[model samples]
Target chain A: MTQVAQAMRDKTAVCGVGLTLGNFQDKSALALSVEAYDLALEDAGLERKDVDGLIQLSFGNDYDRFLEAVGTDVRYAYQGWSHGRFIAPMLQQAAMVVASGMAKAVAIVHGRRRRAFGQLADTEMWRQGLGPHGESPAYGAMGPVFGAAIAAQRYFHMYGGSGDDLAPIAMAFRKHAQLNPLACRTSPMTREDYLNSRWIVEPLRLFDCCQNNDGGACLIITSAERARDCKKPPVYISGMQGVHAGPQFHNLTLPGLGVAQQEVFNYRPQKEDLYAYQMAGVTQKDIDFLITYDAFSPLVLFGLERFGFCGPGEAKDFIKDGRIELGGELPINTSGGLLSEGHVVGWNLFIEAIRQLRHECGPRQVKDAEVCQYGSFLGETVIFRR
Target chain B: MEPSYKVVEEKTGRYLPVIYPEELPFWEGARKHEIILQRCNSCAKSWYPIGPACPHCFSMSFKWDRMSGRGTLHNYVVFHKPWTKWFESKVPYAVVQIQLEEGPRLTTNFLDCAVKDIKIGMPVEAVFEDITSDITLVQFRPGKK
Candidate 1:
């Protein structure tokens, strides 16, 4: 590991986390964010005055407006657009702010409704370059699901799998959701039920997609020393890597899938792709459980391949026979993931990792969980330790 | 004959591409029934999703050159659910990504092709659709063997 990476390891920890899931049509995004912030402060056993740093994404409120609503101020503040890929970077930035002494504690916050006012729906698809996720609305190629659909089609074409292959991922996460009270779709989903679900896009059923609901989530990051005095055990921010981007790193797809301008090939993670494990002084074997950004089920397969848990095209076989289920070789998305749990813009994925590491997840917890990794298909990752 | 999906009479118009100044040549080429993109003078390569600089060689020096408009269908997906009211009648259509012979991929709709007929590696060619007086979308259809 590099000296910079060594110095950053385990210096900061997620001291507190708060989440609110399910439909809240009456509540505005700002109101939901304020509620989550209050709950986080209470969970951390810290007052609003104790927080001196703030980070947020668009879609809820601007940074200045959020501070005003919370009746507090911070020395360090930042805001980014609301995308699942940015969640890991936001958490990494919070850890850096605390580790670098910019703030004693930093709160990464988010609040979103399913169909909020000013939500970038149709307009985002027509963005100047390519719609974020390669959308071309004139062709009726809209929604983030289009990105997943195209990628899944390419994956199936290149690797030789069908829509039936995705049923296991949906079924596995649904099984995990059965144990999570906050999860949106917990009614038992059988194989027939999965095959019977209507298609949102070919090769992707309605079950492959995540649910849209109003929700809010927050995580408080502070130095490990201060975290020791908090209400819960600190989940140390052991290592991290930023989101990989460019022509090759298409949104919602693994590298070498030839989506957009990407070239077609079998993608394998080289040494640099596995840097987060090195920075944490651990390997895939050390990761007790994993949480990945699963806006769609195809992403779960891509995430596994991106992290080198399996080889290219091997994820189809690797995910079968309950391999990714709760007591399997690698239990992924134990809190049901965004696929089953609810999409809180991926903030809840991190919160799930924190909860699992703390052993506070009563029934859904991984057995003897010590280390967990939040990695995505884009290669953005954050490894946490109890 | 009526379609299966509900059609609203007072429907909001279709979403059109925002024509930026740099992309005027591409839209103009489409209006003239030609497919064009930026070809780098230094690298002698073409790129799509129109950009100022050449992605291959990072060269700002480029020209709007006409393409063969012949490519292989590299990827595609069938959207059964319509995102907007304008696409309600066009449900279960195929949106294909065609890899031009020049090595750049373009995302567009396939014309005069059934969703079941769309397959990877199939030869396809560009066709222009005059959706508006000022805007014409460059689409695709099956090509002769």
Candidate 2:
């Protein structure tokens, strides 16, 4: 696709955003979902009666309470998971519902506690038993971070980079958290802290992962035309795409040194074309800010490079420059990403993106910010727009 | 430090059993220091790591085909840390996922080489390393070897 083809043209705008109190553990996912809905309704200067549509993470919260909190009968509703792919697409669906006059307005929300349900919803083994094949026969059980760690281990041996190469990713996001008040700020994590942190799944350390907080977040979605009467300056849904080839065994491979069925990043930007390095027409430099879905630190490395922020394997260097910090080259997770900000599944991720574009941040706000980007768990939907 | 990798049975070979009939050939082959996979008889489907039925067809019938163990590197990642306490000494080792010439992907440890020498889509072959009396793992080495 040409650079012009990737340009942002206003489509739909986010009108209101709200986040529930992030808890270490307390209250169910459903309660948090309701709190966020009510707060978002209040934030937009609208009433519960205004939300006629709803979109939520299929794996996370309770839906009946979500419907009750919105005080709407629910004209349009959706729930699914291919990880983060569902986030932006669900918002797009809510936009279509409003645009088609099926509903006047929609509130999308979700929440979860990592300790309660393993946070990432990695239930591969739970489903393994029903299958007649009897997969558990082998010692190789499919856990969430199992494959990712195994792949990372191989990458380190191939690249000769230390585990410390991943530490900067964790420290960078945590450092971004200090300025974010709503973000979980206990201690400033250092690369040494990340290295010294307790191990969870093999190569991944506790500090290298994100907080699985007990919380919910909400975002009000409406068309660009209707948003003028609702709330917040609308950032259009410029270019959005979701792709799922298959499971990891069939799809993924390692970094520059590995092999796989397909070239991993089909949409990855290239340097020679300058513009080719972006997933679409715009470069990372164009966006005022972005949120890297940091469930695990290495993922941020992949996200940084994948989003065309920096060249392949250059995230370590990009991070060292403190560019993702406030007032740096580009600000990230001004709401303190999943790492420090707390992981409310991908629900909080949605609200953070809207909050940044609305310029509502006090200390973490990017100066003269216009365009913004947001992603879900697996980055099925990485929104790019103004 | 010496490079190594091992699996803790957790409970036992009973609770966390490693009994796979489709792997009769791979295991039997391993006893002889050979690596193989089950190819579906009815559908001509090649399955790695072994399975009871062909995902394509419900056929329980398959033949154990020995691999020449030669193929270009499909994709890989070098892990700077081990997945378990057993691999503590093996902090830096490559767990490669290679697409073999016989048309099936295999995940094995890469060794006998430096990290920088590995390249994308590079050729590699299997070299058996026995851990126990009857168990042998198929480790990948540079194909030219």
List model 2 lDDT by residue over B17-92, tens digit each.
Answer: 2334435567667658677777789998775546677656779987777778788666444445444454556555
Candidate RMSDs in Å, in order, are: 3.8, 7.2
Q: After the best TM-score superposition of candidate 2, give how far the Cα of residue A63 lies from its true spot, in angstroms.
A: 3.0
Clashes in model 1: which pairs?
Answer: none
Report the lDDT tens digits of candidate 1 across residue range A1-386.
46798799999999999999999989999988989988899989999999999999988678889999989979999998888999999999999989899999999888888767787663677677678988887777888999999999999998998988999999999999999989987999999999999999888999999978889999999999999999999999998999999899989999999999998899999989889988899999899988999999999989999999999999988999988999999999998988888899999999999999999889888999999999999999999999
- Output the number of the TM-score-best candidate: 1
lDDT of 1 at A100: 90
Cα lDDT for residue A357, candidate 2: 68
Residue A263 Cα positional deviation in candidate 1, in Å, after optimal superposition: 0.9
lDDT by residue (tens digit), candidate 2, A146-211: 444544544454444755777766776777677777777548777677789876544567776675
Q: What is the lDDT of residue B14 in candidate 1?
A: 71
Task: Estimate how well candidate 2 is docked, as a DockQ score.
Answer: 0.15
